[model samples]
Target: MEFADRVILVTGASSGLGRHAARALALAGATVVLLGRHEKRLDGVYDDILAAGGAQPVIMPFDLAEADDPRFNALAATLAHQLGRLDGILHSAAQFIKLSKLEHQRLKHWEAAFATNLMAPFALTRACLPLLEGAEDAAVLFSAEEHGLNPGPYWGGFGLSQAALIALAELFAAEHQDNPNLRFNVLIPGPVSSPMRHRTHPGEVPENLPKPESLLPFYLTWLGPQSRGRSGEVIRPDLGYDPSRQD
Candidate 1:
């Protein structure tokens, strides 16, 4: 129970990387606060955690793209009131609107992409700064993607927003470099057999890609005590991280 007594928030807990990360964090003994727009899906995750003997999870149904400052502040206030402290945050929520050319990308698509991928994280993190800083050791994990690191054709706003998300993580780490309690880093879970991958690459065989569960170790290491003092990094497990070895 590396994360025993810790409280962690996971956005996009309805599906994909976020859902898997939420369950993994809870299993490792963290009280997982599942945040997403889909109430039913969040309930499923909450039940899964209980059935697996993990900590009881909280379901917070929220639309990331549409959330405003008041909503973000209220979320922080609620966490502070209920959880007392926040130990970690996994910004796994994302918005993707298919593969399209830069010119073909609609204004609304860009707005939604940046809102969920970049703005929401910024607002939430800002609101929860005091709670995170209050913890003995707090970590924030921002999810990035291959297209964000290396922008190519047809990636559009989704790629750009994620690229900004990477920068946001770096900035957070740099700003708090002197603070011993806080750490921020980005994780790039590449080509996993996830819903997003299927939507982006319809022709690809799902069996060929690693299952979402395979990336749990990476999430655990980053969000848990194993990653102490590790900040401002863009970690790519698919690139060369050896999960078999200890961090």
Candidate 2:
């Protein structure tokens, strides 16, 4: 699963699954563009990649929640001027403020969640499509959540955003199904011991759960050449599920 000359963008690259994915992708020979709001944390990941002999990564500190279409377009322009083309994008940034009932949820929190988890990906992908289309084979991966798939009480904004992301991925895939160069897929990294998971399930023993690194193989499979023809599939690695099975 080598990405010798590939250029990939990973949001939320300062920590958790995004950080781990950036490191692994760098190790796999891809020039990873790390995007996050925290400059200090982004530098930490960048230095770690350098220390590990991985390709020197680029850091783009930006807040997804506040990013408007113009900002997204500017980012796309910058990437185009610098990298010329993009091989893939892993939409790993997310916002999970708390678990609350819809009635009690603050409108600001709801808007923020959708902005980061859904709208940002949609706009970012839309902006990057031209760059992706220029690549020989390109992929866009949307992070999914189990609660989004099977919603229950108290899931509220975060859950709704994720569910919308699933639909968004499907819609993008269907729209581009005839385009041999581009593909989109959703990945649900279930029960990973991420900061988001820790906040969501505080009582769970962290040691019992898989770390973010546990999803690397699946990441490579989806983002690299191996997943070229696949599109619009929900990939749930934790369940050992096959994409062929609709249910």
Candidate 3:
């Protein structure tokens, strides 16, 4: 689907799925706002999008883990001053330091994981609500994981944060159910051959997993107008699920 005139923000835009999604969204005619901590990587993605003839993207360099509510609010204000309105926000940023049993996990590790995977998305979305509401259609998508839904041994704080994201998505959807302009949903990009997956499942063969770009169709369907009126749902592209099918 085309996103002509739409302005979308993507966290973790420096690399992996976030990078791929940003490029694809830009190519689809959306003006992208690239958010990430790494200024160098963000610039690379920005340049790639420009070279590909995509809309000139805005690079927002902010560390999600260290940002507070005021910082997020300020970001929203900046976006409003620049783009006027926000059509979508894709929460693709995540942190997984390591896999450890609950008893073995350090307090700092748990805090860091929660801050990036849960708190940042929640805070950013809350701050951007006003901008999102200004659009005719807006979407907030949270990146989920298989371990989050089906918790298993040694998943640790990373898994817990992901599980919380599902709840966060559902809560946002419920809160905005009456507001036809906004929607929220969770997406699980299962077994993608990305750095996170490589780190989490080092034993798995990289070639066996789907490429990050493979999720573009699903991403477009959910973030664009195609999935309008569809919210509070958990989408699993790896399951061959068709989001267009309401049934």
lDDT of 2 by residue, 1-247 (tens): 3898899999999989999999999999999999999999999999999999999899999999999999999999999999887999999999995987788999899999999999999999998888999999999999989988977789988888999999999999999999978899999998887888889988777766777777999999899999999999999886342333322
Count steric clashes of candidate 3: 0
* TM-score attained by model 1: 0.95
Tens-digit lDDT track of model 1 for 1-247:
9999999999998899899899888888999999999899999999988898888988899998998999999999999999899999999888887898888889999999999999999999999999999999999999988888887889988889988888898899999999977999999988787888889878777666778988999999999899998889988876333334322
lDDT of 1 at 128: 94
37-115: candidate 3 lDDT, tens digit per residue: 9999999999999998898899999999999999999999999999898999999999996887788999999899999
lDDT (CA) for every model shown? 0.90, 0.91, 0.91
**Candidate 3, run of 10 with poorest lDDT:** 238-247
Candidate 2, superposed: residue stretches over 4 Å from native: 239-247
Give the residue spans of candidate 3 off by over 4 A.
239-247
C-alpha TM-score for every candidate: 0.95, 0.95, 0.95
lDDT value, residue 230 of candidate 3: 95
Name the lDDT value of residue 102 in candidate 3.
Answer: 84
